[model samples]
Target chain A: MTASPTPTDAPPLPWTCPFCALLCDGVALARGETLELRGSDCPKARQALAQQPADTAAATPTIDGRAASLDEALDAAARLLAGATLPLFAGLATDVAGIRSLYALASARDAILDHLLGDAIMASVRPLQDRGVYYTTLAEVRTRADLIVCFGTRPAERYPEFFRRIAPGEPRRREIVFVGTDTDPAAAGPDTELEAVPFAGDAFDTLALLNALAADRALAAPPPGPLAGLAARLQAARYAVIVWEPGASGAQGALVGEAINRLVGTLNARTRAASLALGGSQGGYTANQVVTWLSGLPLRTGLFRDGLRHDPWALATARVLAGRNADLLLWVSSFDPSATPPAADLPTIILGHAAMPPVAGAPQVFIPVATPGIGAAGHLFRLDGGVVVPLVQARDDGLPTVAAIAGAIAQRLAAPASGAGS
Target chain B: MSAPAAVFELRLRALPRFRVDLAGVTPLALGALGEAEAGRVAIRHGNEALALGELFEIRRRPANAPALHFEGDLSRFDRLAWEMEDGEIRVDGPVGHYAAARLRGGLVAVAGDAGGFAACEMAGGELAVAGSVGDFAAAALPGSMDGMRGGTLVVRGDAGARFADRMRRGTAFVFGNAGDFFASRLVAGTIALGGRCGAHPGWAMRRGTLVFAGETPAVPATFVETGHDLRVIWTLLARDLARAGGPFTALPDRRVRRFAGDIAVDGKGEWLLPE
Candidate 1:
């Protein structure tokens, strides 16, 4: 990895901001006391960069709250895993390479795997598995969408750069509608029309009405006027894009996701329409994509002695911990320091961000590791799931990557014990 | 007089800290093995493979009936009688998840409550639970499209959420209340509920009959009331349900109001409410 040039030496280094799911590449970073964003004023990127200070002291590996060498820590973690009956690997917030090595380790240990954002990922995955989906990418929405519908959520609130990233290149007339939410002013443009339609009931009820009207099904009660109009507009548009955030959709989010797909399917029969789900941030998609490709199952799956078993609800991290099914927990969170492992009575091994604070418990192994975009070079899957963004290393923190730490532990487990040397 | 067949009884010696998987210890599977060989059967306790005799005390006795009996709380035991072909498997207490899943032919009777995904993907047989069941009972496995394809599941007590979701072909009778999203996305089946249900029952269902013999539910606007001139069809369905006894025995005597929809998916499923 090439070191970023000094600000006075040359222009800002071109970098991909891995702060959000967008993976914005049209940004430049200048090396200073901290990495500073030069091109974009995205608050999320600024905040993330500020959190990762360049001159910060590196962290060391520890076992049972006492400082230990990397080798000792690896051995301790391997022993815990070797004696475990059922191990759960959760808080998977790392890049592709990190997950690749971890998958091998998990396979050897017969561990259950789940992401920090497993619920959100399943909200989108379950619907696709149950029926199917008509989905769109960011590029398609920017170039082809004439009418965009923001369903139940305002993308700009969580994803700050969503509208700006998909800003149309040429001057063309477009309509933006926010159903069950207030219209976002940031989405307004000179050539774009904006409208906000209040939901007649809750999101579920409103979608049910829209689907019925769009399908031209007769209803005893009159439909909500604005919803009916929007339904007609969706039918008439050249290409419509429905935007939603599955993470914000609440507990029954899978049903909501399925409803959005149903609405998209209803419109596609008459006109062109597709949905754009805005989530999978913090390497959630990276871990999920890697695990799915390596094993035939998605996240929340277990590699058991019998075979691979994927139980989304039963094998959930919280459920597994509550039920005391797993004897050990291996938590990996290399992107964010705040993403700590859930409190459980079982022994834990953490491969986390370099700046992570000490976990308050006994029988724990804490090994601070490198962040993908900040301290190491890696690749991540974008929110849209179609594009893979190459993350450029901005600095060297003298920290090991999650891949290295996990690989080391796996190696220790695979190798037989050595005799004392003379 | 002819001698009676033997019955295999497994009594839990002690409660295990971790969940145990009893997938292959069904009556038909064990009946093929001698008592000594059956004791050597491998079952999963947490991550380790342990012999059946290590966890349970196995005993064989000559009886008039041939069946496999489990005594004690098997709530920590999962996949009981899984894919069982024939013979009877009786659990005196609650059983864990995937109980009798993919059951081809036989009877799995649980005297107590059951865990999630009970009778999932069942092809043929009967799973009768004396107590309530947890979520996704008779529902599809996480990603599979079909659930409880062919069988009869009779739950004597309340059922948890998403009961019979994505069911393709089967008949499920719940003699008590059910949680939300009842019969969701049901493809083809007959589900008869004895008590009240939670929100959004029969959401997105395609082709199935949801019979609510209890109080009328707050119906979704997408459903429209239809003519109730199907006395013959009701009689046939009610007679089959009555055979299960309990709350279903009085089902044929009640008149019903019919509503057709979940047309949100352009579905043809119906909800029958007793009038």
Candidate 2:
């Protein structure tokens, strides 16, 4: 791959930042004498684009800490995978194309595929599976929802563009209601009304009371004053949507989401209401969707002989590694440069971003891959599971795409044992 | 030449985890189309748009009839017979989430167990599961006001948590043990649990009849024992439950004690405990 030419006199180009699930596509990139990034200059996007090319020039395939040719690295990785009884293809932080190729490789090897955010995905998915949730897409939240009730975590810390994207347009005003946590009062428009329903006790108990309130049940001891009015406010709304993030809600924060979902269910009985989950950073939702479609199960599943068996607890990547159930590990992180292979006592192969720093003790093989929306163009699913935005190529760092690397590995795995005999 | 009964058979060749929304693809709707067109029916596999023929084998057998049959263990298949207006769909094996969801008019029978949210948000239909069922059966979908506005859901085996939640109008009879929060926040309906139940049965229910023929769990503080004699409704409901068959077969003759409260709410919901 060749880097796109940076004209000395051209205007800034609109680029989509692929670092987060928000897929904020309005970034302006100007490749002048010094690379300049403007627009939603989020800390993550700015940091990603401000790196000097010289620092990333050290990207090269390696075998056991020693520099090696691409063929030599692929050969070594294939040898390790072909010899292993059970392999784990994990640390999937890439675009749709990258994950699709990884799924193919995992299927050929009958390996267990898991994402970096497997636990977080399960936190939300478990509730949706056991107890259904009514969710809306980001677009729906932007245009239709009138009452936005944010539960627990603040959206700005993780997704800086969250408030900007969901801000209502002209002639309309939205009400921003925060529950569980205190937030900045100035995040919304001056015309927009903001309210906070702070409560004591855990998220589960608070939401349970809210559920009963929404159901019009009388509480033995009524909750705090602010909470007492929440039921009436929700009932009076024309269209209401509750928002929460499973990842930031503590260890069992997803339980809060489950409770909020039940409340939404109860509220919808009389009025129009829905729920929205905010955080899906690092391509977690995309990976979960891909895995579910191909395997008929979510993350933490094994490609057993019968079929893919989903056991979030048993098939967790960490647990599988700790139990020594997997003989080989294939870590793929194509977006974050600092995302290195986890310290495991097993043969490891890495398909990482070009700017990824070298670990003290390197893996058996390391192949630097192009970051989507930077060096390659691909599709990425948004957090709401409604939109699949395009990741346009801005500049190529002369690195192979994860799809090409994983595809090469899959082809080698499908070959006869004679190919491995040598 | 068109022969005997028309039976459309879809045998699962591979397990699909993503829910296949079988909402509009009924036998009557697809009977006019040829095998090729039927194969082109749209279904979602994860993020990809796939053809129904790519996943299931679609074939019309004997004659052109409005009856569909499925074979294989479809425990991963979701939303089967969803919102079907009029037809017959039979699953020879287990099914996944939202099986027969929003069903209007149909006869859907699963020979094996079913996943959560089965018969959810249904308007009218008859859904029978020969084996067990997961949570929220005959319950409203998330953010929907009414659950199973009109239908009949009969689960032969055990049911998990939050069964019949917010059911507005329907008749649900579970023959086995039910998990926590049974008939919780019920607006109006008839629920008969022939086996033991977990905690918080009839939590905050407004108006509904929950008949517990077996051991009943603890009622919430919001609920107060009314000790009312409901022999008239009990006799009629018991006979209907007996017709469904189960431990409730002898429901008519048993003496009952009543408690009405979710006083928290309308306090009109009735919980009949067999004495």
Q: Best DockQ goes to which candidate?
A: 1
How far does residue A392 in candidate 2 sit from its true spot (Å)?
1.0
lDDT against the true structure, each candidate: 0.87, 0.77
Q: What would the per-residue lDDT of candidate 1 be over residues A271-370, giving only the tens digit for each residue?
A: 8999988888888988889999999889999898778989889888998899889999999998878888999998999998877788887499988888
Q: How much of the true A–B contact set does each candidate keep?
A: 0.73, 0.09
Model 2 misplacement above 4 A: A1-3, A32-35, A51-55, A360-363, A417-422, B1-275
Q: Give candidate 2's error at residue A44 in angstroms.
A: 2.5
Tell how far residue B270 is off in model 2, in angstroms.
16
DockQ of each: 0.72, 0.06
Which residue pairs show backbone clashes in model 2?
A218-B264, A269-B145, A296-B17, B6-B63
Q: Estimate each model's TM-score.
A: 0.96, 0.63
What CA RMSD would you report for each candidate?
2.6, 11.1
lDDT, candidate 2, A24-47, per-residue tens: 887777775555667865776777
Q: What is the lDDT, from 0 to 100, of the residue B23 in candidate 2?
A: 49
